[model samples]
Target: MEQEGEVPHVLIFPFPAQGHVNSMLKLAELLSLSGLRITFLNIHRIHQKLTLHSDILSRFSRFPNFQFRTITDGLTPQNRTLGMFSDLIRRLNSITKPLLTQMLLSGELGPNPTCIILDGLFNFIVDVDAQPKIPVFSFRTISACSFWAYSFVPMLIEDGQLPIKGEEDMDRMIDGVTGMENVLRCRDLPSFCRLKDPSDPALQHGVTQTIQSLKAHSLIFNTFEDLEGPILSCLRRRCPNIYAIGPLHSLLKSRLSGEESSLGSESFNNLWEVDRSCLAETVSQMVNDVMENKRNELMGSVNETAKLAKTSVEEGGSSFRDLERMISDIRFLYRRQREAIH
Candidate 1:
């Protein structure tokens, strides 16, 4: 437990997938640095992978205000079994939601949790959000374009753009979704949307997550406006309170200290083994290019991404202020709750 007057506490739960965990972990660190107390919840199986493949536990200890908690993912060691994994995900939400609710109501996580930042992918968390006095905000770690594509599943159905007839319809343009008339095709839509059977569970799950996001107090995306401005505009209809502060790697790199943070980021997304061979290949290419007096294509492209990321985090930037605003809102919630209790 923290001291009575500690910074407002937050509980963060990420989907156990490697990519999801990595982005949310960075967001947790950012919130912690901004003077919030953050408790990051990890599933037992994923945490074990971090222990074996990365430095997650040791890396987080340096933050005075951040800590971790774990619960079972309801799966065995092999997360590869899709049928088993899908069943486990359903059980996880039903099982973990109540457990998390119990933890919060007991004040075991801290004095009072002002907010719960959850991965937007889970349907069950919204039910947890209904518990009195605690709010859940969703953080969607997907690109805004993909989210916008997913958001239109219903519209597609209405326009007969979905339930694609066959492979022949795959290449047809989806004219139903406004703002994407020329840009989006059936094949370009999210993979789940490609399923000919509209009743497929996987397809439904993806749709549910996108729709469920609307119920969250706020919806945050790990993308910046310059990159996905049009799709983000479309998303605002469903989620008015949206924040796009991403290329999260850039945001973290800009604000954090040095190598320690970088190293932690390495395993943050690599639940699988990394191909360090890319490094060897790149260095070799650079040497060859220099001898031939030719432009280095890979290095040039990387530098471009780095440049864009850096530009997005400058003073008075979208990501910087949105992060500050999120922390402030949580503190405001904390104060209001305290006064109400008295």
Candidate 2:
């Protein structure tokens, strides 16, 4: 039960992958900075790797209310590369779900977590029990463009657009995607769209996740409106409550403008080692091209992008306002629960 004047707590569970953890960790830090008590849940395997690579504990230690909790992914010491999500999901249903319930009921994890921010892929876990219930929001650590592309698979299949006939059909233009008709093509769709077999697990994963998102209170994406406005507009028709505040790392980084705010911000934990040499080579070529192309003519747009990230999460700022709304909703839920209990 929440105490008087106590900050409402939020439980964050990422998909246990490098990119997912990196982006969500940044969001966790952002929320902690905003005065919410945060409980970051991690799979032991991924958490182990993250600890080995970076000072995750010491870094998050700055926030007294921030803490890490780990559950087993039920995978071996081996890395999860392919067909691993299936096992992870099975373990979640059998192991983690019950464990989460136990934790919530026992109050062992602190005052009942007011809300759960679950990964979009972990669709099976529903509302947790309390006097009322813990509201769960699904956070997809992917671009709105890719998410919207995956969500269209079922419609494309019904209309005979997916499962391309052959190489000849690869470059064919795709239609009926409400906002992406001009930009999307057969080859441009997610790799899952290329699977001709309906029973294929990878393809099925996309379908299930997209369909299950409707069950959540809100759909959150680490993408900003300027980049995915059209897709977000279409998404809102389905989920209705969608938060697309992203380039999240940059957004959070911009907010920590003080000199001391630089601590641990540089650690972007990557499970897959980044090939900086290839990156450097590509960046060098891009620099030469940009220097010659006079992209300074397009500098206004670049500055606008930077300005958006630097904007505080105030009434008008995209991320600032979305996060404020989230906190407000959770606090309201907490108050209702307290009333019911009393």
Model 1 spans > 4 angstroms off: 1-4, 78-80, 83-85, 126-130, 257-269, 273-279, 282-306
lDDT of 2 by residue, 72-97 (tens): 66566464557676776777778877
Which lDDT value does model 2 have at 91? Answer: 75
Least well predicted 10-residue stretch by lDDT in candidate 2? 123-132
In order of appearance, the predictions have TM-scores of 0.86, 0.85
- The CA lDDT at 182 in model 2 is 73
**Residue lDDT tens for model 1, 6-118:** 57888898998888898898888778767788898888777767777767677777778787888765565566465565676677777877777677678777666787888
133 Cα displacement, candidate 1 (Å): 1.9
Regions of candidate 2 where Cα sits further than 4 Å from its true position: 1-5, 78-80, 126-132, 259-265, 272-315
